[model samples]
Target: MNQPLPQRNEPFRPGETALLLVDMQRIWLEPGADPSHPERGPDHYFYRHTAAETIPNQERLLKAARANGVEVLHTIIQSLTEDGRDRSLDHKLTPIHIPPSQPEGLPVTSLAPAGDEIMLPKTSSGVFNSTNIDYVLKNLGIRYLIVVGIMTDQCVDMAVRDAADRGYLVTCVSDACASATQERHDTALNAFGGYCWVADTDTVIARIEALGKSA
Candidate 1:
């Protein structure tokens, strides 16, 4: 008989866990923030979904994380060089370039980083590959990551999978994330479901509260 793998069911610990917001920049989340976003129109499903669901859930998660003393981190898709030389090959090929000082580089105001919160600027979809996020997380003694953000099928997916592969316990907040389409978001979650624990905003916040009580 094959031996069963050990299951992990411990609640999140405040000092050992972090909430990572991936690519929640204005260009992607806010309508009319980027020129192409305006072309997509204000009523586009992506914009509607974000405004109606993702951002609201993210606010809840942030509140819970902050109150529970879990570290919060943000990532933005940005280029280190003005000429777009520092971007990853994939970003270059996709022509995804957000200049460092562009207004689009800022996070949406509602869920913006608070005092002393860390923000990582990356030129690649996978923050682990592009930034010193691993080192920073390790330095902070973080073992578990709660991930929420934009482009569920891209950067968020990469963060979840990469963080799991690097031996971090990862939880993906489904309602706190979105993609260009609902189908893409659901498909990406299904594909990456094996890599991390999947939970909704309410469930995650409850877990945080439970941990706080325990602490």
Candidate 2:
């Protein structure tokens, strides 16, 4: 059997880390988008929110990470053309639609980082696959990645796995990510825990606060 990777014992070092927020678009949250799937609608209401509810937690993580001087990187699954010609086979299979320009200057989803934050566009699930994300992270000397976003089982999982494979310390804020169902979200978290630090929003907040104090 392969030896297990060691757990991260030390708290996050803010300056060396970046927070990556993945797709959290309104199209995935709207009621009529999937009428047959009630979970994706606004009615599931767990913890005063549904499975589509991840905006507040994402916003909190973004604020905390920014306050501590951690780099913020936002990723959206958009194609290079209006017809989505650059989309990957996986994207083509999924119903998520990303026009070439929807994420324009406004915040359609909690996915957008602030104006100063780095914005990366990807055609595949992992941000590093078709984008210059790796180059930008390398140039910034970022070695730790904090991931928070929508669809825990898809883009977020892919990004976390890729980051770990690339030798970055990865942390996934469970409370800040969501999926269409509890089963999907939980399953992904369980699998991801083997590769990355699976943490709650409170834990991440405390870690960021500690890092801020140390700085």
Candidate 3:
């Protein structure tokens, strides 16, 4: 089995790293019609739910990342239109049911880029796949990526692999991520361990806080 890259015990370089939050929308959180299986109706079969089950912990990480002045970027996997022409094959296989136009204050809403937070609209698995994320990161001179959010095995795994391939230092906050099943979550984390640093929420937060104290 591939092991995760070795992580230094110290905090990441705050000035050159950012926290990427992926797919935390309400549609994924609440019980609703499964876009992947619309024929099953809203109440049929087991539903794939978000880690919002662990929202408090996720929120803690977000708060810590923000307080440390790390750039915060939010990503939502929604198509530009209903037809989803912009979506990749992976998206077509497991579709998300977002409306043609995402209203303001909607769950998974895009962040305003003016606040040093870039909102990346991705129609695919990895954030780097069809977005300007690479350019933005390069422009900001960022070399490390601290990733958090839902579906540990899917989107998160994709991001970690792609980031590593691009030669960026990557880390996954284990406790801050979730999946439909513990097995799925473990599988992704183990796979990611081969390509990125994996740390629990507390460890990651402590490192970030220490950075604040030293600075």
Candidate 4:
């Protein structure tokens, strides 16, 4: 019989943990926001799943994080330069440009950044690669991260792996993330499942709520 790997199932400490929302912008969440991708309409799998599962779960996670005093940070895809000359080479090659003033680049209204919440704008798929997020997280004393967001196979995957590489304990809220298809979402999670703890929204919320009672 094989022995199980030791787990880092430490309870979340409010002050040392943060909830990271990655690229949950209007461009991705609202089908109308990016007319360039007309195929992704209201009934598309991504949108349907996001509306049915991701957003609602994220709302629950956000509520619990806020109520329990956990740090909340949001990341959006936007260029620092109006002409997008500042975007990473990969972004330019992929033709992913969100002008500094683009409305679609802003966070979706439903899960918008609340008062005093930090918002980091990046042009790369990985927030840590394009923004000063590592420094900021270190400075804020954030040791553990609870991540939820769009394009689970891309930005969410990068965030999870990169954060783990940088030595921050990571928990990915699987239900709170969406990809273009269910297959993509599940595949991405399994691909990087080794990097972080994979958890559902309900489990994460219960943990956050328990933090309050533990105090």
Q: Write the per-residue lDDT of candidate 3 for residues 80-149, one digit (tens) a residue.
A: 7767776787777765435447542134322223355677777877889878898888888877788887
User: Per-residue CA lDDT of candidate 2, range 43-143, in tens?
Assistant: 55432353334777777888888788889888876677888877788777874447766634233554455678877767787888879888899899988
* Distance from true location, Cα of 101 in model 2, Å: 3.0
Error of 4 at 112 (Å): 0.7
Cα lDDT listed for each candidate: 0.90, 0.75, 0.71, 0.90
Cα RMSD for candidates in order:
2.4, 4.0, 5.0, 3.3
Summed backbone clashes in each candidate are 0, 0, 4, 0
Give lDDT: candidate 3, residue 57.
Answer: 60
What TM-score does candidate 1 get on C-alpha atoms?
A: 0.93
- On the 0 to 100 scale, the lDDT of residue 203 in model 3 is 85
Clashing pairs in 4: none
Give lDDT for model 4. 0.90
Give TM per candidate: 0.93, 0.84, 0.80, 0.94
